[model samples]
Target: MVAPLKVGIAGLGTVGAEVVRLIEQQARTLSARSGRGVQVVAVTARSKAKKRKLDLRGVAWAKNPLDLANDPGIDCFVELMGGAGEPALSAIEAALKSGKSVVTANKALIAKHGLRLAKLAEKHGGALNYEAAVGAAIPVIKTLREGLAGTSVHRVYGILNGTCNYILTRMEQEGLSFAECLKDAQRLGYAEANPSFDVDGHDTAQKLAILASLAFGTAVAQNAVYVEGISSITPEDLRAAEELGYRVKLLGVAVRTAKGIEQRVHPTMVPKSSSIAQVMGVTNAVTIDGEGIPPITLVGPGAGGAATASAVIADIADVARGIRAKPFGRPVEQLRVTSKAPMERHEGGYYIRLMARDLAGTAATIATRLAEQKISIESIVQRHANGVDTALAKGKSSPVPVILITYATSEDAVYRALEAVQRDKVISGRPQVIRIEKN
Candidate 1:
């Protein structure tokens, strides 16, 4: 008879606690599916005295994460304590070193030390699974690592962060400013007190690095991702997107190019008809474009304790079933080292918003600058100023807003044209540029 797979979990926070409850609740289902019973035998947390509504009658509490990880009775170690360094890192290492399978939901740690940890898992012959780290309950990791194993993937992109997506959704639907939506998100517990990690694109960048590795077979490199935040997005931009048949989303995109894989995170203008654009609120979506297969898009609730616990339990089930796929879909020794693709060389469509001076020569100067850089405009709209003729008749000057949609062009050319336009004194303030991603 197969013995129950004993599990030790570290950090009994929201996700960890839920994982324990689910293991007991789903024991029969898990055993039927995995061909073995799964048990949560040991656990540890920052404060064991902190009362949690969990049943630990048969469960033993360890002194700390390391002690729990090294416990001989457990067959699997689950790490829920999140951080890029310290106890989480050492504990996971110790667990792998002991030839025990490990599961975790720590994206930051995976992005930074994933290659190192993956190597340890390989050397020690134990499974290293982190299905919950990228997208909670989305199954994207398995899709890329296993489902598409026979196919060749060229592009992978998504809306990875819930907080940023919620902010953008509120701004587009209700015409709210970034700050206002952010304040409301914090109040609703969707955002942290220090929201820079999510809003500034770092969180998406980390998740992107992990996906890029799985899709492109490259070593996880968070620094390679070019990051731009949603804080620069404005109501006017969202309104313009609506009129232009597009929606603004904070997207993390990784695609193969002639030069190399390009990974970037920023507020992108996606066609309204695309699958990813339809996603809103705290939901998450990822689109993977393979060589021969049609694009596959996975969408689901990205966060919350229940959603994340679902993914963690799935990883544990894989371990119980004796499945040990490569951590990044490839052996660490075979993973290629990748660096940041230069943004100036990035080629794509661009949306440029300029505040032009309401002078006769301003329009002419702007056109001449763009022409000098060999940029072709797909469309241009000059928003009519309220009572502009009356203001001109009264001998006043105001800046007219001009929006331009450009065909395929280089990032350097766009910046050069905008810089020349700025130097010529034809526009007011800095121009806003958003990249366009087609379906």
Candidate 2:
């Protein structure tokens, strides 16, 4: 009989603890499916004394992550300790170099140093699976890496971060400001105290880099993603988007273009009718558009102990089944180097909200500038002046809100026209711009 796959997990946090529980609880099922039993024989964490409430009766507690990774008794190493550098990286590296399969849920590490670790896994003939790195329990990584291996993918985009999605959802549903929703998210343990990583779009950017690499067979590089946070998104923007038959979502989009793959993360206006826009709350969703196939959208809980653990266990099962596919869906050497796509060259419909001065020729000046840039306006709405109808406030000097939906245009042209409008003193404050992603 084939021996069970002995697993050693580093960092017994929420996810690691849940992984152990699932392995024990699902041993029979895992064996039946994988053709072998899966066991967590060894584990390590920052504080072993901490009461994780997990039953580790026969498990060996290693001294540190490196010790656990290099344990000869273990066949698979799982890293739950998150960070872009240090012990997590070195531990994963050691595990890969030792010819043991490695599983992890660290998106930052995967995005920044994925190519190097993938190379090590390739050279050493070990399976490197990180299905939980991008979307927890969504199976998107597998969909791109194996399921869609035969198909050519044109675009992959999604709402990758749960915290940002929750914030935006509450803001849209409750009509609360971003700050109020963010505080509630933090209180509910959805967002961190600093919250810069999730709110500023860095977390989404990291996840996007990983997905982009898998979809396009490019080397993973977090720096290549153009990131814009959801902090600047206001309730007014959300209202305007609703009126325009769209929903504002913090989306990470990577699509193939004539120039190259354009990867970006920002607050995007997706049509209310689109599958992704229907997703609300802290839920996560990803849409993959491949050649000759209808768009496939995978939606699930993007993060949490149970959700993330499911993906990790699935990856471990793949390792147990002796499935050793290329880490990034292609050989490391074959993976092309990806550079930052210039955002100025991005071509898409734009939703521009300008606080135009309530002057006689303000709208005319704005129209002239946009026309000069050859930007065709799809629709324009002069909403009101401080909640009062523009017509009623005849002599009010206060700025009136002007919302414009422009046809497909270059990002540079939109900015150029907005800059001219600002210089001509036709608007007040910086304009709020959201890219439109159609279904």
Candidate 3:
């Protein structure tokens, strides 16, 4: 019988424990398939004795992850210690330099430094695999590089963050404000103690950057993806979106346009009946439009110990079988860097709410301002206190809320027109705005 493939684990956190669980759970089947057993020989974490449920009786615990990375007995280094830099970065670098296969679940490190690391792995003939980085429980990275190798993907996008998805789902379902949804997500443990990374759209942007790098054969430029959070979304905005036959979702969309790559993470108004809209709660959904692969949509759990470890073990299976590919499906030197589309260059429909005075000529003036900018309104639903337009008929000065859905338009024209009209003294509150995506 062939000798077993030895694996070393770093950072015994939630994911680390899951890795152990998976190794044990799938041991018999994995060994039968590979014709060689895969064993966890050692592990690393900050604590030598953190009372945990994961049985470490047969596994040796290493205080320093770097030592485990450099160990000759370990054929693969599985680094779950997440962070952009530090012991995780150092350990990964050392493992690659030593010509050992490396697997990681750190998107931040991959987003910020993927190009350099990919080059290093190639230089040493080592594999840099991070299927767990982009979408946990979904084999998207592998599906892109291997399954869709023959087809050219024009765009790839999804709701990449589960915390953000949970909050948006709650807001759409309960008509709750962003703050209220966030508090509920916190209690549900979907959100971290500090939710800025997820709620602020940075986490989705990072994952999008990573996917874009692989899809476009370019270095991951997370900073290029425009990010806008949903914190400003009010219950009124949710209701308006619903009335307009749309649902609000935080989308990380990437398109390879003729001009450049357009990557954006923001609150979007998708058609209510669209499949993406139906993906509620902490579930994640990704869509890819290719030349001949037929549009593919994969939806499942975005994060969790079991889901995340499923990705890690998939990569481990690759290592055990010696299956590997270029980190971005092409050599680093051959990768092309595409410029990101400017925000003002974007064209889309929008949901805009304006607070208008219940005075005669105010509606006409606003209509003229919109027409002057060629911003044609598709529908206008005017609201009154008693469901009567009598306040305006009586010439009484009152604040009337006007909800509008505009036709698709150019951003430059919208910016110029809104800038001039928003400064009007009669306009109440900053005009609440959210862009609509028909896809």
Candidate 4:
């Protein structure tokens, strides 16, 4: 009989508990498929006295994660804890050093410190698998690491954050303001109480760093990458984008430019009819670019308790079947970690909103400056402000909100032209420029 591959899981809040449920439900089939049976020997969480539905009667329950990590019977350590530091970090370090395979769904940890941990795991000859980390149950990590290994991937971008996508979709469909859409998402449990991580694009930024590193064979850099949130996205922007045949979606985008790699997370304008533009309401999608094959795209629920656990189990089955692969597609040394292209050199279409005087020559002045920078106007929309144009204006000198879409231009050129327009006496306020990602 094949010996059972013992498992030790930490953080049973949501994902860890789901792991137990999956393992119990699929034990026999997994044994047959893996050529070995799997056993849940131990679990760790903050509270053991709390009620749990699964059967833990025969399994050990540790008050602390370290207990599970150090257990001799545990041949593999599963970390479901959601942070980049603390017990999760310590436990993973302990497990790898103990010569045990480690599986994690912690994208934050992986994005922040993947290369270091990969080196340690390789030194110990134990697998450091995180298929669950990037896209839940999607196996994107494996696809990039193995399936597409033979190809040279040039760019990897995705709509990785569920909350932002949900909110943006709601805004478009219901004509709801950013705040109202966000409130609806919160009420539906699609967003967290503290939604900054998702709404502000930090969550997707982490995932982007991970995916970009895999695609480019480079070390992931989460903090160094530029980040922007969806909070400033307004209903006006949404309506304007729609009228212009565009959709504003919060995208986690990464492109390998000649200058270097450009990584950013922000609300971008994608064609409403494009594949990525149609991925609405909590659904996730990733697009990969490379040489010779059709662009590979995978879309799904990037996060869910059960979906995440499914990826965890797949990694464990690999251990059971004695399968091992590179932590991030290639050897750590061979990974190309280079400086990304400066944003100034990037050329892409843009959406801009500015509060300008409704007087004559104001539009002409704005146009002239953009013209000097070679920015061509594609579309424009004029909307009266709530009070700026009403009770506050002496006459036609009132500042009306003007929104415009521009054809693709270099980032540097746009900023230079904007500087000139901002200083022009004809303009009344600062300009807000949002990149249009028609990728």
Best by lDDT: 1
Candidate 2 is scored at a TM of: 0.98
Cα lDDT tens digits, model 3, 390-437, are 323335566777777889987776777666666655467778778887
Off by over 4 Å in 4: 381-401
C-alpha lDDT values of all predictions: 0.94, 0.93, 0.85, 0.85
What does the lDDT read for residue 21 in candidate 4? Answer: 94
Residue 373 lDDT (model 2): 96
Instruction: Tell me how far the alpha carbon of residue 152 in candidate 2 is from the true structure, in angstroms, after superposition.
Output: 0.5
Mind giving the per-residue lDDT tens digits that candidate 4 earns over 279-311?
Answer: 988888998888898778898888889888899
For model 2, the run of ten residues with the poorest summed lDDT: 385-394
Model 1 lDDT tens row, 323-382: 999999988999999999999999989999998877767777888999999999998878
- Model 4 — TM-score against the truth? 0.94
Tally clashes: model 1: 0
Residue ranges of candidate 1 with Cα displaced over 4 Å = 386-396
Candidate with better TM-score, 1 vs 3: 1
Give one digit per residue, the lDDT tens place, for model 2 in 101-218.
Answer: 9999999899889989999999999998999998899999999999999999999999999999999999999999999999999999999999999999999999999999999988
Ordered by lDDT, highest first, the candidates read 1, 2, 3, 4
